[model samples]
Target: MLNTWYYSDAPRTVRPMLSVMRRQSGFAEIIGDIDQENATFEARRCLSCGNCFECDNCYGVCPDNAIRKLGPGNRFEFKYDYCKGCGLCPSECPCGAIMMIPEEI
Candidate 1:
């Protein structure tokens, strides 16, 4: 049940372009629908494991004080203000917890 409003505009339909426009629109609709369905399924599969949403696995292990303890309700806040991105937190997580995203260069 994807909403079609998210799709980009159909291309211009000139003499030689009409077929291409149709094909592009069809492909866009199919891809968008499949992606929407996959997203819905993945959202349903999350188990919400009892571990803390902000489980301080990284906070406890960081040697450099890079990760900060923001008073938590959910989701641990990282103080990239000083994080060296040593990749320690992601490595130490027993549940495949944190992921190390690249810092902006």
Candidate 2:
């Protein structure tokens, strides 16, 4: 099994933030909202809010480019043809929409 970390009574998972300039831009693109290291640390801290606001974190962090942007408010789709189950989507997903399930070899 891949190693995982757990936190208790620790700091909360910092929500993906938009820069002040971006915020003022009204609809800013938050592609690289969360970093890999930051995402890993926030695993246990995740709020599991269960809402995909379509921040595009998965789109940017996907190394395989498996995620497809269906346009504004359309959400996204996974192209299994490209997905290698690298676990980046789930880790980068701000909302708990995407999750990783172990595939038996």
Candidate 3:
């Protein structure tokens, strides 16, 4: 199951009215939090391609058990021995981090 509050499978909705709001407010640099814990929290929002944040969507959704969980902070590994190349992991990825490539012959 996905956390709907944090994860969204569908494309983000566009807010056309936000442009009018922006025009009224003008553009400004919104500084991010400088605290370490706050920074780490924000870092979790990163896509983390070729890396991992242990979101577990892949590990939870794989039908073939090809994605292995290596515990917290260790990330995941693809178990080619059991993988079927279903393309589901990359498809379900919310952050657009994973990409598919053709195998070299």
Candidate 4:
């Protein structure tokens, strides 16, 4: 045991890269459609460098539903009794917020 939760068998879903370019409204139009919502989502796609941004990736992917939401800005917590140590939460964690520590005897 490396004292960590490593899910080597977890399946990873690869999403296609979206190219968001400034597209003109018309063939000859110079103005573009400012999609602020889409832009914001795309902006969040940037690498978080292993920080919790409360994106809910871990919370959403937990099969056991062991991860509990602590409301907005509070992040989440693991219900160890229900967690079963499946490593699903750690694997699905996009920002590496969940670290798997080995259970000591």
Q: What local distance difference test score does each model get?
A: 0.58, 0.73, 0.65, 0.66
User: Using alpha carbons, what is the TM-score of model 3?
Assistant: 0.53
Residue 20 of model 3 has an lDDT of: 55
The candidate maximizing lDDT is 2
Encode model 1's per-residue lDDT on 18-102: one tens digit a residue. 3556777665432223355555655544433433356576788888788767686755667877787788877655455566777
- Cα shift from native, residue 13, model 4 (Å): 28
Q: What's the TM-score of each model vs. the native?
A: 0.43, 0.51, 0.53, 0.55
By TM-score, the best candidate is: 4
Tens-digit lDDT track for model 4 on 1-105?
121233233333333333334233334334444366656655645555566778787788888989899999888888889988888777777657678999999
Candidate order (lDDT): 2, 4, 3, 1
Top-down TM-score ranking: 4, 3, 2, 1
Q: State which candidate, 1 or 4, has the greater lDDT.
A: 4
For residues 1-105, could you state the per-residue lDDT of candidate 3 as single tens digits? Answer: 222344534433332243455556866433323566555655555545554456787888899999988888787889888988888887666555566687788
Better of 3 and 4 by lDDT: 4
Provide C-alpha RMSD values for all models, in order.
Answer: 14.4, 15.7, 8.1, 10.5
Q: State, as a TM-score between 0 and 1, how close model 4 is to the true structure.
A: 0.55
2 against 4, candidate with superior TM-score: 4
lDDT of 3: 0.65
Candidate 4 clash figure, as a count? 0
Model 2: residues with Cα > 4 Å off, grouped in runs: 1-48, 103-105
